[model samples]
Target: MKELLKRYKYAPADQLPSYCIPITVNGKTCGRLRPITPDTLHSEEEIRLLTEWRSASGEWFTTQFPVTEHGTRQWLEQQVLQADDRILFFVDDEDWNPIAQVGFLHYDEVKKQCEFDNLLRGRKGRFGNIMIYALLALGEWSIRVLDLQTGYLNVLADNARAIAIYKKLGFQEETRTPLVKQVEGDVTRWVVAEDDDTGGEAQRYLVTMKVRTEGFYETLKQIL
Candidate 1:
């Protein structure tokens, strides 16, 4: 898995696979999961689109800040493309138009585990629940090809829609931690504050969920 991850991370974007996987629904390809590359950010418009998605979806995230194209491109280069343990993919429709983004991060080679990160439907109502299949595709590849033992994700406990989707994908809730918003300058980040009962300014809880790799593919098949 480490070697494969290295290839995905270090290999030339053009040389790597065109897509991480193709998402299928009802025996038809609905979208493709393409890794974000330099080519993906070649155009200023592309960067702006990504920035818009992040800004629009900020409410569901722990951190909220004014998103800018400069910041977005910097993050893509330093935090994503340059990182060895993380890989981000843009979910493109059948026509190859990017509609969403999903990826895995914080890979633990020793434990064969990783966290599902940055799932956002940038363009809504275009694919019609295709994000679920896109997630399943990534999860399957992570387990079958990358040989991961478990997959995990952290979601805002108040995000009922996202929580339901994760549950449908076979992730079981493991823990929930109370969070308090900390504001500094233009950024506001939700930080772990205290126990669930010590409610003062902490209004949100972060929920961690896990899914075993053993029956991951089977679960995908069942869903499909």
Candidate 2:
């Protein structure tokens, strides 16, 4: 599994192995989840779209910073494509146009656990339930193909919409920790801070949720 992940990460996009999850409704294909690679997004327009999407979804993330094409391209090359433990996929329409991004990171080889990270729906209202399908597909793939024992994700406690969707997908809350916002020039980071550090008025609460690999496929089946 580790070797497979390494190949997926380092291989050129054209030479990469096929790993796609198709979204279907009533026997008709609707969208897919395709792996994101540097080669897959070498075009200027692709980088621009990714930058715009990341910038637009800033409110839901732990780090807030102005996203730019240059930074996004660098991140794609360094942080994503070259990282050994991270893999991101594009949520695309049936025609293969990217609509959103979803992926996993922080994989623990000994524990067989990983966190589902970088989930953002760039195109709103176009595919209402596409993100849900994308997550389910990713979860199933991780458990079955990668032999992951557990998968988890963190969400803002006040994000009712995302929490509700996560509940429906069979993730149960594990913890809720207070977070404090720390600002550094041109950037703001949400860090887990002690209750006393925030003077009883923390900036936000981060809710961590986990799902067991044994029940992952069953949950996907129920949703489908």
Candidate 3:
């Protein structure tokens, strides 16, 4: 039988079950990864999470998000589901429990470029590293199967942990810029060429990571 995650219901749970795609490394299906969604979009979450994330170290929620479950579900569906969008992968646990998600967004057939959106682990889970493994494998698959020019993500400058993780996965800083209207605040943009080994192989990933809503980062990593 094809493996699948056991369903679990939560507050106002109304969205579809998250997707799972097999990830192969060295010709073996080692794991899987979950991607970001519309309701789970980080355009705003990055900012909110940074506010509290800065105050604390490690991963754990200090407070609750302001939005309702129903509202969040509706919003994510609209934002994530679009033409030319192929996938978001959620890495599952040993018992087939989802623990994290990462999105490889805006697949451009003509330009051969796809952007890496959100990559986050659950507040409660045991397979955090599995998710990272899945994401890295997925990135390689995305490059080969999708015929991508480059894959990338925009991370908050202060998020040293995430930046470090990306670097280990063969991503490098392509550029950094200030977020509009916020003096002294900026987002570090990380980019990677498919075969990039020295960090800067030469290719422009065509995608703009932007904040679409205010204060949406805290819960933006959650599965809707």
Candidate 4:
């Protein structure tokens, strides 16, 4: 319940990277970025967002991962029950006020990957950048502190902005199957990955394709 802002020193329980942690960006306090637990669910603002996100059966959800109220309720209820499943984060302002929510849902422990989904911010513009910075900070914290080797996400293929951001953060297109159950009406799967376990060639291609191609070019040059 502590306000996580600007260089907050809080650490995660059980050393899991997905738990709530302190984060800051460019020397400014970013506030407490943590998992959405029943304990933290008491906030009115949090409850409001949860309700709206559920009711939003709007065009986005309908087009992306359509489901009924019952289905959505079941999933939200499970967030509190499943041990490995992390409601990754719903950030609050300094006063325990909910600002935006972003987290990895549908976690697959065996694969050490999860889908980075559900980001809702009340404000616009720089809000996206703040949430993204927070996510990367958590990624590093999870990797170094929790020993997680990889993270993955599924973005809406049409979401160019989000795709660009994930790419900028080093997530690459992947063929991994969708972890979330897609209703019959949903769209095709689109996924991305970041990890220590990427195949050597895949990693090379992802990290520096030009360099790899240049190496091949030099080899051919030498042959010629």
What lDDT does the true structure give each of the candidates?
0.84, 0.82, 0.46, 0.49
Tens digit of per-residue lDDT, candidate 2, span 36-63: 7667557897788789889987888889
lDDT winner: 1
> For candidate 4, what is the TM-score?
0.57
Q: Give the CA lDDT, 0 to 100, for residue 53 in model 1.
A: 90
State the lDDT of candidate 4 residue by residue for 113-194, as single tens digits.
4555666555433344666666655665555544454566654444566667666566667642222223454553222333
Model 2's alpha-carbon lDDT is: 0.82
Per-residue accuracy of model 3 over 171-198 as CA lDDT, tens digit each = 6676654332111333222334344333
Candidate order (lDDT): 1, 2, 4, 3
What TM value does model 1 have?
Answer: 0.91
Query: Lowest summed lDDT over 10 consecutive residues: which window, candidate 4?
Result: 203-212
- Each model's TM-score, in the order given? 0.91, 0.91, 0.54, 0.57
lDDT of 2 at 41: 54
Count of clashing pairs, candidate 3: 15
Q: Stretches of candidate 2 above 4 Å error? A: 10-17, 124-127
User: Which residue pairs clash within candidate 1?
Assistant: none
| lDDT string, candidate 1, 5-115, tens digits | 656655566675554578888888877888777775677877887999999999899999999999999999888887888898888888878888999899888888999
